[model samples]
Structures are given as structure tokens and as C-alpha cells.
Target: MNGSEFARPIVGLTTYLQQAQTSVWDVHASFLPGVYIKGVTLAGGIATLLPPQPVDAEIAARVLDRLDGLIITGGKDVDPATYGHDPHPTTDEPARDRDAWEFALLAGALRRHLPVLGICRGAQLLNVALGGTLHQHLPDILGHTRHQQGNAVFSTSTVHTVEGSKLAGLIGETSDAQCYHHQAIDRLGDGLVVCARDTDGVIEAVEMPGHDFVLAVQWHPEETLDDLRLFAGLVEAARNHTTERVNLWPPPN
Candidate 1:
């Protein structure tokens, strides 16, 4: 199908709540990768944003039912308890609301075989959702240089290793990425294969070879636009899935 023939895909972005006010919240929203849809749209694809918060299972399902793909954005550390562990001293308290909402959204997306792209905490959530665990605090246990570089905002770093992987093939070897988290994947979840890691052996990327399009990265791809191949891949995959579904069932007579 031509790009214009491809309908605009609604991408879901998970958000985080500010501590000060119960109602106040911040959506670590980004347009870097989202902008890729523009190119897709220009090429004939559509794109829309779906923020993750006040998650309603019914709403999530309805959204996923219509969306061609989903993108889970980065945020604070996930609670250790979700994966069966006491809270680590270094671990930040879990966002119960976000956790509950995202868990449902991920489950629904997976069940439907919709394409998913997870970034940072989104990656961790995917792991936890699939019965995996996290390191909680990298510096305390991993013995690696600070992954969360001293920057309140996003900070860019070098991602070494460019072998054979979807991510590597998309961005090539040695691409600059933003690091903003202290936690790393400890025990990989089921059906997930480590695709990329740092020199220190930290899991940077994970993929489900059997799934339609399940890819997760620990870095913030949305922080950089030049390397939006990842998002473009997702949009393309969604477009294909949508086409396949339509082809499987012709319009009513």
C-alpha cells in the first residue's frame, strides 16, 4: 500500500506523576521519534499520540484495537515488588497508578500482536510484565560507571556494539543515545532476547523474535531525531499489520 494509503497510527506514550501534587503529572512526551510519522505521513502514513495515565482498561483496549502500534516511553524506576522483590534501598518507589495502567495496556497489546516499541522504563515495564526482574540500582550492583550521568535532563552517551540486530541494522554500530536511568535489566523476561548491551554487559536492547514487533531499548531514542529509524521501523511494521488485517477481511458487500 502507498504511504497515503496507510492510516495514521496512534502511538501510546506512558507518563509519570510529579510528587508535589497528586493531580499534577508530567508526560515525558517526545516528538523525535513521533516526527518519523510525519515522514511516514508525508510518504502517506498517519500518526497520533496516546498518553499513558489515568489508564482505563476498556479505553486502553479500544485504543489498541484501533492503533496499528504502541510506543512505551521512558520514566522513573519500576517498583521491585512487581517482579517479586523487597524494595531496594536505592530503588525509587513504584508508580502504582502507572504500573497498573501500563501492565494492562502491555498485556492487551501483546495479546492482539500489535507492534510495540519500549524505551527506558518502558523497557523495564515490558520485562516486569513478562515475569522478569531489574537490577534496581546499577551503580550499587553492576560496578559500572554511572549510567545515569549527572544531568537532571536527558544526557547523551555512546552506545557501543553494532553487530547483527534489528537495532544495529537500523541505526548502525556506535550510535549516540541519551541515558537517564539508574536501573538495568537484571533477569530477562520470557521470549525476550538481548540484542544490545553496553561494554559493562548491561542489557540495552531486547527483542521477541517470535512476536510480530516487540522491541525494547534502555536508552531514550525519542531524545534524538536523526536516528529515528527505530520509530520508522515500528510505523512501517504497524502499516504492514494494518494492511494484512484489511486484506484478511474484505469490505462488507
Candidate 2:
């Protein structure tokens, strides 16, 4: 409700490319579940859907040029080849197209230092893109499957936030969170630090300190309507970015 939200930043959310099925339609499409758009819009920002691209760096830069904030929404497993690892039998098939497209997008966003909020698979993709490795199968390492509930639903986990971390004020020091992930970050990436975790020590959130706003979480805030700080935080950061951009290049008198 402060002045930071006055600008109503345009937040670009990336989508998936796959076969979609509805009662009257079944076809290949580039799309995201409506939850992402709902979350951004409810948080006092304009949401825009960004379809996947075909590994084009120039296009990625042009896309970031217009976006004040970026959201890499969840999707299929990331390609292990991205981080020099081989596929695991338990790992879901990699979506190479999405991986490359998002990687390029992340690269562009990072170069511009734009605010970025990543969720679920988006978190994993951010990690991999920044030179981190993945466990590929959490059940194998933890001997439990609580992190991933079967079929289209989120499981609950008591997650603890790191004190003084960027997410502490938003997600709290300890809170029950909705989660659904089979893989997790193994070795963290460059410029990223853990901000929270579940009881089992699985990394829950990460942030790139000293950046305007670059954060990722294993859970999806967009799925729950009660939380808006996460999205609002990005919006505020984007507003600051917009102000800086305008000052750097004033319009002609």
C-alpha cells in the first residue's frame, strides 16, 4: 500500500510448451496455469505470459528489455546435461526446449539486474543456469517421499526460514508451506545463498545477495491465495528498477 506499488510494474511470466487438453480442445500450446497470472495481478502488478523460445539470446535480451520483473514458472524436469550430470532412472524426462529457452531468459534478466522470482521447477532451473547441480531424486537421498505428493496436488511441509535472509520477512522464520518437488538443489550456484529449508534440510529458498531482487523457492506462492508479499516484493523491486531506468534515459523535452 506504499508508494512503491504506484507504478504497477509489468511482470513477465514464462510458460511451458506441451500438449494441453481441455473438454473441447486438445493441442500443442505454449501456456501456464492460470494461477501465475492470478497471483501477479492480485499483487498489484500487470502480468504478461511469455511463451518459450528456441535458444535465441538476442530475442531473450529484447524480451527482458520490456519486462520490469520476470517469473520463471514451474514445469518438467531440467536437462541434467545443463549441469554436466547424466540422467537418473527416477528423474522425469527433461524438457530441453523449455530448459534452453528459460536459460536464455535467465541470462538476459541477470545481465540487466532485473527483479526475478522463480517458483518450483523455476527455482531448480535458476540454480542450474547459475552453475549449480541437482539431486535429481530427493526420495533416494532422504528415504522419504513427503516432498512430492502424487498427482497434481501439493504436499505440506514445515519449513524454516533463515534469520536475516531476504525471505525471512516474507515467508517467515517457520511456516507450513505447500510443496511438490521430486528433485532439489544439491550444490548451490554462484551468488546464491540458502534462505530457508524443510525439516529434512532440503533447500526451500535462495537469493542472490547484492542484486536488486533475485529469489527462488521450491514451493509455489501462486498456488495459495493468502500470500501476496512474495509477488509484491518483486513488484516493488521492479518499481525501483523502473525509476532507475527512467532517470538513466529521460524522455525528450
User: Which of the numbered candidates is closest to the native, going by highest lDDT?
Assistant: 2
Q: Which tens-of-lDDT digit does each residue in 1-253 have in candidate 2?
A: 4454367888999998889998999999988889889888888889999887666988898888998999999889898888999999977787788888889999999989999999999899999989999999998999988888778888988889889888897767887778989999999999899998999999988999999899999988887778788988888888889777866675657
Where's the lowest-lDDT run of ten residues in candidate 1? 28-37
Across residues 10-92, which tens digit of lDDT does each residue of candidate 1 receive?
55555555433225754443223444344345433455655446666787798788777877777667878899989878777
Error of 1 at 205 (Å): 0.5
Off by over 4 Å in 1: 1-5, 19-47, 51-58, 153-155, 160-162, 250-253
Model 2 steric clash total: 0
